[model samples]
Each structure stands twice: as C-alpha cells, then as structure tokens.
Target: MNYEKYYPIVYKQLYYLVGNNELAEDLTQEVFIKYYNSKEQIEFLGAWLSKVAANIAFNYLRGEKRRIKREENILEEVNNIFSIEDEIFRSEQIKEVRKILVNIPDKQRVCLILKFSGYSYEEIHNATNIPLNNIGQFIARGKQKFVKLYKKEGEINVL
Candidate 1:
C-alpha cells in the first residue's frame, strides 16, 4: 500500500545519510522489515519509518562504517568538467566536510546533513525527532561548528 509510496522517500533519506547506494538499499530494506514486523502497533507510519531510518543510519555511522562514502561512484562524480587542480581541491574539501560532519554533535549533525541533503525542515524534524521550533537553531549551530572545525582542519591539514 503505502510501501510503494514511501519506499522511495525512505530510500532517498538513507541514501542521503550514507551516500552509498548498496548500503542505503540494505538499510532501507532493514527499515521496512522492522516496519512490517511492527506495523500493527504503529500510529504514524511515515514518521516512525523516518525516525527508524535515521537511527539506523546514525548507528551505522557511529560504528566502523564511519569510513562510508557520500556518493555511489567517485569516477562518475569526478568525470565532470573541471580542471585537475579543481578536482583535487574539491576532493579535499569533501573529505574535510565529511570529517567535520562526523565530529559534530548528533542532533546538530543530523539536522545539517538532512538539510544539506534537500530535506525540508519539517521532514528533518520528523526524521530526527527534533522539534520544529528548534530545527533552525540546531542547523545554525551546526553550521557554526562546522565552519569552526573546517578552519581548524585546514590549519592542521586534517584529511
């Protein structure tokens, strides 16, 4: 029923979180499996599914999977028309941004990542269990912390 409707939404959320196609697909399957097993007791299916997906992605990120990529194919992404030096610089920036995203506090980090991934504030709140009123605050704080860490990362050559 709604599975056909919400599957892509959940999958896209996970894809944005993990940035790896296979992993996102696997995690999305896991989310739906959990939902299927517990569908009766649930009230709001979309919110429940979103929250579960976020938690699973967060747990995966917290583990050794922190080395995960944000894209399925590096070559495909890099094939864009850009100079060698520009590509290299962009690569370094992406690496540093990933590192900073990992280091930020969980709430802030999730908000920033979801927002960056194109989720609306309402969707971010649904997925994160963050209140609508405070989503903006966390996002702002996340950006500040990210900029602060990025500057330090650049100085220390963190990559």
Candidate 2:
C-alpha cells in the first residue's frame, strides 16, 4: 500500500480532532510510524489509522486539561498567600491608626475611623447620630488631629 496516498487524509482528520495544525501534523507522523513498526497486519489501513489518531488526540486533550487545572491551582495558591500577607499588613496599619485615634477627641475619632472603614458620610451620620452638616467638619478635624498625632509618633509619610 502506498501510505503516502493516505497522509493528507489522515492529517486532515487529526487536524479536525486536535484543532491545531502543528500538533495534528506531529500526531499524523506518529500514527504512520506506529503503523510501520507494528507486527500485526492491518487489513483496513485507513480505519486503523483513524482509530489510533483519535486515541492519541483524546489522550493529548486529557493531558492538556490536567495541565491547565494544575496551573489554575498554583495561581490560586499564590493569590491566597498574597491575600494573607496583605491582610496581616492591613491589620498592623489599622492597629497603629487605632492607637493614634485614642489621643483624639471622641467625636473626631469616631468619624475618622468610620470614614477609613469605608462608610459614607450619610451612613456615618446615621451611625453616630452626628448632624449631617457636622459630619464633614468632624472628618476634617479628625484627619488633622490624626495626622498630627501620627507625625508625633515619629511615623513619616502618612498615608
């Protein structure tokens, strides 16, 4: 049999299955090599080559799925580790800010902490029952006092 006659047919079949031209060409070559090396005679060469190509393509897809899953797991692990470190750093910064807040007046400290913790001015007013008009003033005064106290504690580059 002139195997050369079937090369293009087998390559096209593999390309359709694998969706990659280079990989299909490589697998087609491998299929022919396997056919040539086999001791058992194949009566239907095309059918045998198709089955072998399908199996090879299936195995390659399975391996690619496993590799992608492993990469995703590694990326997730790295992100989790970084998140933990960021949480710890944020905790330390919050602690330092809390210590400084203690030196400020009660109203100013409350307003500043609520603002830093991501509360809107209206929400802060509702929570603290401070007047809507005074909320801005409180936040401004609180920030000024916090900055002064933070500087006094020998901390440079506030925020």
Candidate 3:
C-alpha cells in the first residue's frame, strides 16, 4: 500500500477531528500503525483510517480527567520541543492569550489559532466550517483581546 499517498488525507482527517495540529499529527501516526497491521481487511483505506482515528480521538475526549491530563502532557511535550526558555516565553504569551480567549468563545479561539498560525481566512473556514465573514470578526476580536491582555501583562512586568 502507498502509505505516503494517504498521509495528508490522514493528517487532514485527524486535524478535522481534533482541531489541533500537534495532537492530530500524533493520532495520524497511531492511525497509520493500525492501518499497517489491518491493511488486509480494510477497504477504502482512507476512510478506514479516518474512522479508526476518530473513534480513538472521541474516546479520548470523552474522559474528562484523561483529557485534562493529556492536555497537560501535550503542553509539556510542546514546551520541551520548543526548548525550555522559548517555551517559557511563548507560554507566557499563550497563557495571557488563553485567558482572553476564554472570553471570546470557542469558535473565535479556533479562528485565532488558525489565523495566528498563518492560515488564510478561506483556509480557516474550510478547516473549521466557520463562515467566511465570521472568520474576520472572530480573528479581529481575538486579536484585540490578546493584544490588550499582552499589553496589560507587559505593563505589570515593567513596573
């Protein structure tokens, strides 16, 4: 089987399922491993992998304690990957942004991450199923809130 051919499909599927690139990437790898072992029985390999990944992701999400711990673990891993110093700096910004983001609502937070990560409005719309017009509003509000939070924190640190 041509695993490489389906890699992007698996990635997109998992990304759509999880809405987080890092977690989607991890789940994608797990999905491919399952596919490797069960390839013979799987017809429409792409769909099979997607179903498996979604099931796994959904199960993971259903457990609140597990999900919270997993998020902490993931954030720790992300921190490690970026190096301690860089992680600390980025985390400070992200923490402030997250606090402000909570006030923006879920869709806006998704839009904020997608846009901040460099996706275009169209791309965010496609990925998130959010309306095109609203992407701008979400991003605008999210950015403004983040800027305010960041500036406020910066002022406190300067004193």
Candidate 4:
C-alpha cells in the first residue's frame, strides 16, 4: 500500500483535533503503522486510514477531557479545604502558641509543632526518625511545658 500519499491528509485531520504539529505527525505515523499491520486485505486504503485516524483522534480528545476534568476537581477540593477566616484564625492561634513554644526544650518543642501542624504520631516519627513509642511521651511533655510557660508569661504580663 502507498501509505506516503495519505500522510499529509491524515496529519492535517489529526492536527485539527490535537492542535500540535509534533503530536499530529506522530499520530499520522501510528495510523500508517496500524494500517500496515492489519491482516485483512483493505480495498480502499485511503478510506480505512481516514476512519482509523478519526477514531484515534476522537478517543484521544475524550481521554484529554476526562483528564482535564479530574485535575480541575482535585484543585477545587484543595481550595475547599482552607477558607480565608479559617486560615486567619489558625495563623493567629499559631502565633500565640509559638511564643510559648520557644521556652520548651528543643525535642519537645519540635514534637508539639509537628502535632499542631497536623502530623500524626506515626507521621512525626517517620519524619523525625524518632521512635514511635517516644512520640506520645514527647508530645505530652511538650504540652505540659507549653501550658506552664504560657501561664508564667501571662502572669508576668498581667502584673
């Protein structure tokens, strides 16, 4: 089969759907390869090639749409997870707590910060390479130290 004659036409059709010269060229090559690999004897090679290229382009477009939609949904879900007011409140609370966090021992301070930043005990252990069993103890000690320091600071400021 003289497939070279159909290359330009197939490329033009694929380009219209994919809108990329390189991709259209690649798809056109793929179409010819599929046609050449066919076991059945084709009567009209041009028509068969055109039909196959159209089907490939259509399937590609459908899959692209689905992928774009899935990305959009993921972005929307991420945006919904944080609101402006929630962010502001969380920042202010963190600022207040950070004042007391400085007075705590380094290990306890780190564990407390990790816990407040939404890290689970296992996650903190993994990230810090600290033992899983020690994580809870660290967090408990951190919290107790934080409360004591906070009270002391508040009392000093009040006086």
Model 4 lowest lDDT segment of ten: 77-86
Residue lDDT tens for model 4, 38-155? 9999998888988999998888889989999999999988887767668988998788777888889988888888998899998999889889999899999999998988888779
Question: Residues 4-99, candidate 2, lDDT per residue (tens digit)?
Answer: 898998899899998999999999999898888999978988899989988988999899999999999999999999999999999988888778
lDDT of 1 by residue, 1-159 (tens): 499998999999999999999999999999999987873788788999999999999999887444445343564567663567688998987887898889999999999999999999999989988899999999999999999988998788755
Residue 90 displacement in candidate 4 (angstroms): 4.1
Q: List the residue pairs that clash in candidate 4.
A: none
lDDT of 3 by residue, 1-159 (tens): 777898898888778877889988888898888877773776677778778888877875677568898999999898787798787888987787676677766887899989989999999999999989889998888778777777877798799
lDDT of each: 0.89, 0.90, 0.82, 0.88
Ranking by TM-score: 2, 4, 1, 3
Single out the weakest 10-residue window by summed lDDT for candidate 1.
Answer: 64-73
Cα error of candidate 2 at position 121, Å: 7.4
For all candidates, the clash counts are 0, 0, 0, 0
**What residue runs in model 3 are displaced by over 4 Å at the alpha carbon?**
64-159
